[model samples]
Target: MDLAQRIQKMITPTIKDQGYEIVRVQITGAKHPRLQIMAERADGTCIDVEDCATISRSISAVLDVEDPIEGEFTLEVSSPGIDRPLTRLQDYQTWAGFDVKIELKTGIDGRKRYLGRLLGLDEEQRILIECEEDEPHTLAFEDVQRAKLMLTDELIAAAATEQTK
Candidate 1:
């Protein structure tokens, strides 16, 4: 497995035990790698500074023991924020009806990028996206390269209401 995936496997249990979910784990920069761990409450609540600090300490302890990274690396723990990434199958289903930007691994119909309102997953587990000009596009789950919600007034309002609930 890759470095990020290996690290995730090691740290996920600890995060889950703390009532949080790992959204994504990314390693960037070849020379001085930066490990970024995006996380959130299991109930979909936003993470605070205290939450980050807590996760950081927990992950640090695990990393120190595991010795996953070879050299010096910076670990960053943070929330996914309002316009969060759609990294898993459940994320697409959960964020249905929201505007999203998705990049495919390969071009479909001469396009590799698309922006549309998410229609969730179909029976075949394909993601459905309804664009402005045409019929909804169905994408294979494996085809997704990157997907993220688009910031909008509707999204902001939903987040605010979720916070109050």
Candidate 2:
């Protein structure tokens, strides 16, 4: 497996034990590997720098024991930025009514990109999105490639206040 995949496997349990979700993982950089770990709360409140630092230390402890990588690298545990990726089913439930940009593998409406307010899930396990029209668009769970909760000013303000404490 790749470095990101390796890190995710190694660190997921530790992250979850701390009540955080691993949103995405990326390992980039040639000479020195860089591991970027994104985490968030169920309500979409991002894991902040302080949170990351705590998690980072825990993860670093594991890395030291496992010795996954032969050479030196940088470990960056962080929150999924403003335009954070929506990867899990719980993400849909948490950000209901928030605008999301979804890219489908196959275009259902003759287009791949969809920008709409999430309306939660339906009985059929499809996401109910309130698009431009009054009617809601139900997109299957398998369709979304990458999605992020569109951050409103209120969200930013709340996140800022959260960090202050």
Candidate 3:
């Protein structure tokens, strides 16, 4: 498994016990590697600074013991904000009807990126996106390199509604 995957496996139990679920784990940079852990409250509430601090401390303790990284690395814990990434398959269903930007690992129809309304996943588990084309484009889940919600008034309003819940 990759470094980020390994780290996620190591930290998931602790994070879940703390009532949070990881959105994504990414390790970037060479000289000064930065480990970014995006998480959200399992209760469907917004996570705050205190939650990030708590997660950071807990993850720090776990990493110190495991020593997963060869050298010193910066660990960052934060919530996936309003325009969050669609990392898991459930995210697509949850955020259906929102505008999104999806990039594929390889070009499809002479394009690598697509911007349109998210139609969620089809029966075959492929991502469905309605672009400028007449019909919705069906994209394989494995082809997606990265996908995230587009920042729009509708999304902002939805986020506000979620926060108040």
Candidate 4:
């Protein structure tokens, strides 16, 4: 597995045990490497600064022991913002009815990009999206290259409400 994937696999259990779930793991920069870990409560609650610091310390300890990186690197922990990538399968279900942009690994009907309201996962695990005025689009989960929520006034309002709760 890649570094990010390996780190995710190694530290996910510990993070979950701490009452949080890993949203995404990314390593950026070459000379000054940075490990960006986006995390949130499993219950879909907003994570506060204290929670970020807590997770950072816990993850730092694990990374220190593992020594996954050859050189020094900076670690950052934060909550996934309102416009977050739809990484997990549950994300699609939870954020259904929201506008989203999805890119497929292999083109579907000579197109790889799609923008529409999320329709969530179908019974067969395909991602359903209501695109255009016609029938909703069904895509294989494995075919998704990238997917993220579009920032809109409704999304902003929903995020504010979620943060307050």
Q: Which candidate leads the pack in lDDT?
A: 1
> Could you give candidate 3's per-residue lDDT for residues 1-165 as a string of tens digits?
999999999999999999999999999999999999999999656689999999999999999999999899999998899999999888888889999999999998798999999999899888899997667898887888999999999999999988787
User: lDDT for every model?
Assistant: 0.95, 0.81, 0.93, 0.92
lDDT-sorted candidate list, best first: 1, 3, 4, 2
Candidate 1 achieves a global lDDT of 0.95
Q: Which number leads on TM-score?
A: 1
True lDDT of residue 50, candidate 2:
84
Q: Which parts of model 3 have CA positions greater than 4 angstroms off?
A: none
- State the lDDT of candidate 1 residue by residue for 1-165, as single tens digits: 988999999999999999999999999998999999999999878899999999999999999999999899999999999999999899999999999999999999899998999999999989999999999999998998999999999999999999888
Q: Give the TM-score of candidate 2.
A: 0.77
Indicate whether candidate 3 or candidate 4 has the larger TM-score: 3
Estimate, for each residue in 48-131, the C-alpha lDDT of model 2 and write its tens digit.
678888888988999999998779998887888866778878778866866788888889869787888888888887888887
lDDT of 2: 0.81
Reference-based TM-score of each model: 0.97, 0.77, 0.95, 0.94
Q: Report the C-alpha displacement of residue 64, candidate 3, in angstroms.
A: 0.6
Question: Where does candidate 1 stray beyond 4 Å?
Answer: none
Task: List the pairs of residues colliding in candidate 1.
Answer: none
Give me the displacement of residue 81 in model 4, in angstroms. Answer: 0.4
